[model samples]
Target: MSPVNPVNPANPANPGNRVGPTVHTTPKVPVASSAPGVARPRIALSTVALECPDAHELAAFYVRLLGWEVEREDTDWVKLRAPVREDGGGGTGIAFQSDDTYVPPVWPGVPGAQQMMAHLDFEVADLAAAAAYAVASGAALATHQAADDTRVLFDPAGHPFCLWAAAGAGDGADTGRG
Candidate 1:
């Protein structure tokens, strides 16, 4: 039998002459099937983006803290690449996008005003040393510290994050795997 468009039954090369089920040649975003015994697709978190008044300023703060390099930047957006792992794979990225309406979150969360939407945590060999470095790099140590080995500080844009003393590092004490 001679199909309407024999070359391609679903979608004929001639757009004006359409035929068949209108074959969708579009590519998907790549999801894994849920069939049994099948290896699921590995979903990795690539970046954690933060909204700030100044993307470049916030990115600079993280760059100094993590010793990461600015992979990309613009007036309104910035991307900082984490230090490469010893295995040679790229670490997760951190991005900052400028938001003029950005309001610094209040730690412990306030009722009406801005509350912390998210925060990052870091493990350090020495809590005191790390906190000092952060302060020197324009971070302010929060007064509401609740842990002996964990210090909470606000970045230049007022995002609160924690720096914990790693287990068996500073005082040879297990601070619950900071």
Candidate 2:
């Protein structure tokens, strides 16, 4: 879909809130419809979208780190999906959209800094291996760590995510997978 202008008319309550363009998306499965003329809409949470300087570039990093497939793509937008399960159901997804004005958010936010909005979390059996793989996939280890069981890393576009070890794996022991 072509990008639309992001200037919405101002509301009295929300003075300068610039609403983003509406990007059309399709549901993974058909949702039940409301009765005709009911004016009700069924809503479901889909992928979590991130703003970045380059959609495809950041998406490539995630595709490597998470081993998810590209479900959809365009010049300014890309969507990724985890591999389908044996139950034939689609896994969770994420999307990236290009924004020339995108600013990378900072972790362990400081005053006047671009504070992190939200972060992704992945449960890992071997925290050491997962953290290593994430670093190799273009993610930089964050300077501040808040928890023993979680390692904070920033994606190529500066979105923070955690590599969390399962219970009792807090020491980040490495599995000899090599």
Candidate 3:
């Protein structure tokens, strides 16, 4: 059996050639102009806000660690500006908000909580110097890894942060291993 077009039997090439004219219709859509009236979100370049028992104390620790200067300060809020290095890459800005009656979180042995909610990880050219600076800036070394030699430190408000030696400077080979 051969297939045949029921619409047109005269032209074999035109399978559906019965139509004298074809119509193409476009769906209607509401268009809005991208003008001054259009609403747009005011986005920030970068923001990292933290809750601490004392905003001033926490802000001071970060300022010393990252060499950041205070951009804004008040009784309840403090913001630090992360200075840009000679390289293109920039540092992070930290904001601290006061939290009254805040209890420090205990990791590992704490019931129902095995880890911290968030932690700041830093790569330093001189790990020893960084650790010393952190200590001088009111940070306590909480945990240390003998195998990898990385250390986890906490600020006065018990916010966990880490200091690790940067790679590619006689630290170790890029051993594809964690």
Clashing pairs in 3: none
lDDT of 2 by residue, 36-91 (tens): 67877677667999999999999999999888989999989999987888999866
Q: Candidate 1, which segments miss by more than 4 Å at Cα?
A: 1-42, 171-178
lDDT of 3 at 127: 65
- RMSD of every candidate to native, in Å, equals 18.5, 12.1, 20.5
- Please identify model 2 stretches exceeding 4 Å from their true place: 1-41, 168-178
Task: State the TM-score for model 3.
Answer: 0.64
Ranking by TM-score: 1, 2, 3
Question: Of the pair 1 and 2, which is ahead by TM-score?
Answer: 1
lDDT of 3 by residue, 84-133 (tens): 77897766688999989676766322446543566677766666777788
lDDT against true structure, model 3: 0.67
Q: Candidate 3, which ten residues in sequence have the lowest lDDT sum?
A: 18-27
Worst 10 residues of 2 by lDDT: 14-23
Pairs that clash in candidate 1: none
41-131: candidate 1 lDDT, tens digit per residue:
8888888999999999899899889899888888899999887779988878999999999999987554687967677878788878888
